[model samples]
Target: MPRNNDLNIILGDLKSLFSIAAVLMSAMVVSSLLFWELRSAAGFIAGMLVSLIIAAAIHSITPRSEALELKHAIIIAALAYLLIPAVSAIPYMISTGMSPVDAYFESISGWTSSGFTMLPAPDSIGHSMQLWRSVTQWIGAVGVILLMVTVLIRPGTSAYILYQSEARKERIRPSIRSTVRTIWKVYLALTIISFFILLLAGMPAWDALNVSMTAIGGGFTLYSDSIGHYDSLPIEIVLLPVMIAGAIPFAVLFMMFKLKLHTMIYDIQVRTFAGLIATGCLLLVAQNYFYFYNDLFSATRYSVFQLVSAITSTGLQTTDISGWSPTALLIMSIAMIIGGCAGSTSGGIKVAREIFLVNQIKLWLKKTLLSKKAVIVIRLGQHKVVEKTITEELNEATLISFLWILNILVSIMLLANILGPEVSLSNLIFEVCSAQGNCGLTTGIINPAISPLAKLIFIADMWMGRLEIVPVILLLRTVFRGFGR
Candidate 1:
């Protein structure tokens, strides 16, 4: 591709993203208008204008090119993801009269699919504003996948390579664009189905709409207490399947839809994801039996819900896990960190990576017992994984897991230092893990009462976690280089 053409392609992507942002802003404005929130409508308009100006300026100044280097693609992806949240926060600030930091924090949390809330309560916020929050998550979840497919996918090869960097390597279709469209279609269909299901379960129209959006997006509901407010076991049961559906890999869903039963059954990632959920649920149930609830059925219900919530990164809770035993809390935290399978709406390191790492370890142990003349190869499913690929995947998984541990440790110490020694260190770590994994389950630590600095730290962790850290790091590197120049 010609240099000029490559730049043009990059510019085109920027323009396209800006156009999408403008559309989202318009949705917010229209929704606000319906709810008679003129202030929010105006803010939406202002945000759109700002985004357009920035996008146009970048497009005009940047050279047009047909192709871009992988580095440029990574830089652009990171910057665009960061910029959108910052711009989206304008309406929140204007509508809710929140401080700039709080607005940005909320916006980042929504876009990153982290369910943490700094708002006083959902009831206090305007209907339009609440809708905007849910809408932002719905859009963000789809937008993240779309951006990965469109801008990051190089020509001639499927974008699976770029997808892997985002911890989503599965392909639902032959082409990146097709895969994106398919996922969007499935996601939209599920959202609609979930909306009606909630309505049928007797939730009001507004609640149904908001919950559906959050459920399908693998996001937390707007209510401060989440599903606890419903006080309806039927509603909770209805939401259970929807959250699980949201966490399922889109590629596997597509295969199932296409009647590829064997493919669905044989998928390594899907089986592993299911197994992890089962294992986590069993442990939590056992804890409930020994401590919280003596009734088996009641204990099982809450345990399964909590496990699903953490594994899916949806953050909806039926009961408080803070009061649970230490072993239970630790198990749930681990579930949060592992999260759902890759190529799903859920976030975190992902079960696929975990499975891969475990299989790699087993292979390593076997290799130590092999004879010198033996030729052995590590395999996943039907594919023969090269030693290099195995090593690379293992290294990436280890690095990410290590960082998660380090971040949790740092956050605990910071929170303890600020909140005093009375705070439980384990609970603090759980909160940090919840925010970083976008799991949203808290041990009652995150709230309006928390200090501003701690809130900001959690917000930053959410953003870094959502982007899987690399893009944000690259953006910082770019800034430092520019300053040096």
Candidate 2:
């Protein structure tokens, strides 16, 4: 690619993101109006105008391009993830009176769909601000690039690359525009349906909308107690499927909705994901029953909900996570780290990767134990996975897991040094996993009182987790080299 072209691609991609931000700002403006927040509405309108101007200026300067290479897509996607949240932080600072760093932290957390918050009293956040938070997660759920593809980009190779770069690997339609449109259709339909269900379950309309967005995005809630704030079994039941839907691939959901239920049911990844959740829940129930709560009903209720929440990376806590026994917390932490299926809104290592890694190990052991000349095959579902394919998948999975652990360890050190010895190591590990997995469950460690440096680490974790380590690292390397070809 020509140097100028690369610059143009980056600028153009960023322009699209800012354009989306402008639209989100308009929604926030309306939200502000609904809440009678005059200053907040004015601030959002001003932000929207500035974003539009920047977007237009970039579009005017950048040369027209029909295609973007994978590198271009990665760079653009990475930069957009970083920059979009900075723009999103404006409302937090404006409405919540949080410090600039804290506000940016909140925005990054929301944008990454990682439910960590610096707010001392989440319920005290302005209504518009709370809605904006949910909206950001909703946008981040599918991604900004998907929105751009639907509204801004023409159907082309560039659009597809950008779509894939946003961690969306499947297409439900032939054309990029059609695919994005269909995806938005499914997403919107689910959001509306889930909102109504929550409403029928007795939640206020406003809360319903917020939870619908948050649940679909696999994001934690604005309420400090999360889903437990409702204290209604019906509401929890209403949200369960919505969160699960977020964890399932949109493509699979699209197929299932089209009456191809076998496509999702027989999927190896889906089966493994479902099995993992079920097993985790059972183990947690036993652990809680034996160690924490003597009552089976109480143990099962809390255990099942939190286990599902953690596994799906939804972060809607139904129990006090801090009070969980060490064994139970460890199980939940592992579930969070394993995460949901690939190409879904849920984050973490993803069950697909974990399954691949396990299969690779099995293949290696079989080959070793049988004979040096033994031919080995790894199968995922009914399809035979070739050695080269399995190797690549294993490499990708292991490298990502290593990086995830390294980042968490670094963050843990930072937290311990800043928060002192009183901070529980297990809780810190749990919190770090939550951030890195985009699993919003926390042990009450996240708040405004934390050190500024620690907050920056958490911000980086959320960003890194959402981008899955590769794109962000590549983007950083590209920056370090001054974008040299």
Candidate 3:
């Protein structure tokens, strides 16, 4: 009876998860029919039907619950995130005829908003699949749980717990429901604005729509060559701000809608993000100008856009960087690992946590060397953060950062064993960082034709990176020791 109770508890919220999931999958089915120019809607219709059957089957059995414990929240969060990508993979398998691993890799990439493409030949994929990838990025950026809050969960401890499990905590409103819906509004507005901007820049409607959705979430592009295929300065210029916008915290984005700028100017995350991008841009400009491009205009052109895309974790690129200098690649690697602001669509260690860790390091130094008399109180913004508060928050932030580095090292080791000494160590490291950081920039080592084992490693990195590591940790523990959790 106790075991049954636990099972019931676990299955509780998943009913709503699958129910809403079916609804979201239907949008792709509609999109498929809308784009009847290719394989028509058969693949999409089949994908949606399978997804609906699964949702219905799950909904029929899942026991309802009033609330979720922390463990349950983590489990539910991990399960939904993992499952949606798997179910979404059905479409790719049916339509593109990609191998299961490759198709799942493609689904995971889009759902994690990592933008890595595993499609054997992207050009041959139908328009529906193309749009599905963009939609996955858009929905993934908003989050499955956050979407759940829109129509499923009500106000309570369970609501907030489920929301936090999505790797977000910044409350833009008094209520979780209001906050998520507002974020949805902000995200929608940003995408719409980006779409029109790209359209004005002379991109075709479909291209503009895909870029708007993918760029806002820092996801993959439609073409194999990425942004470079267009070769239009206007398109690149239009996308630069959109990519950076993906990195700005949703709270700041909401403030921007209210036309608030002075307060935003004082935000440490904003300042830090700007500093990193500017520093990276100048460094890349110098390297490119002297080593490759030679022309200042051309160097700056490639430098600024690529650097912003890297820092934002947006995979769009205007050049085939397979030949870029190691120095340039390394510079972008740092940007990718540092990542964007907390609570933004972009992924990485996050700017807010980085600031906390930096301050924590200083606090430790002051106590050890400068003495307690130094009185260096840790602060995030205008507010004075208590020492205990700093310690509490810093603990998780540091743990996640450590695991992030460990994952990078492990992923690199695995890739090294597979690729051997033929590949440049710099390129290998750069590719690993890009995958784990959810920054889709390719240093040429990762591609559709890469070994299947290598693809799985990247898929793991994307999953871990998207969950920011801890939820994945909790998930593994639950899987290995159910009762222990």
* Candidate with maximal lDDT: 2
lDDT of 1 by residue, 1-485 (tens): 22444445556666656766777788878888998989889889988888888778877777655454554555556656667778888888887888877888788888888877778776777887888789778866655536646644355343543344454555677866677778888888889999999999999998899889988544557677888887788998999888888888888777776788787668888788888888888888998888988999988988998889888988888877788877788888898889887788888788878877887887788788998666667878777877678888898888777777787788777778887776787788788889888878888988777788988888878877787777676667755563123
Question: TM-score ranking from best to worst?
Answer: 3, 2, 1
Model 1 scores worst on lDDT over the 10 consecutive residues at 156-165
Between candidates 2 and 3, name the one with more favorable TM-score: 3
* Residue ranges of candidate 3 with Cα displaced over 4 Å: 1-3, 37-40, 120-123, 369-375, 483-485
Q: What are the clash counts of all predictions, listed in order?
A: 11, 0, 0
lDDT of each: 0.77, 0.84, 0.82
lDDT at 71, model 2? 86
State candidate 2's TM-score: 0.94
Per-prediction TM-score to the true structure, in the order listed: 0.91, 0.94, 0.95
lDDT of 2 by residue, 273-313 (tens): 88998899899999999999999999988888888888888
> Compared with the true structure, what per-residue lDDT tens digits does model 3 show for residues 200-249?
99999988988899998656777888888899999999998999998999
lDDT of the structure predicted as candidate 1: 0.77
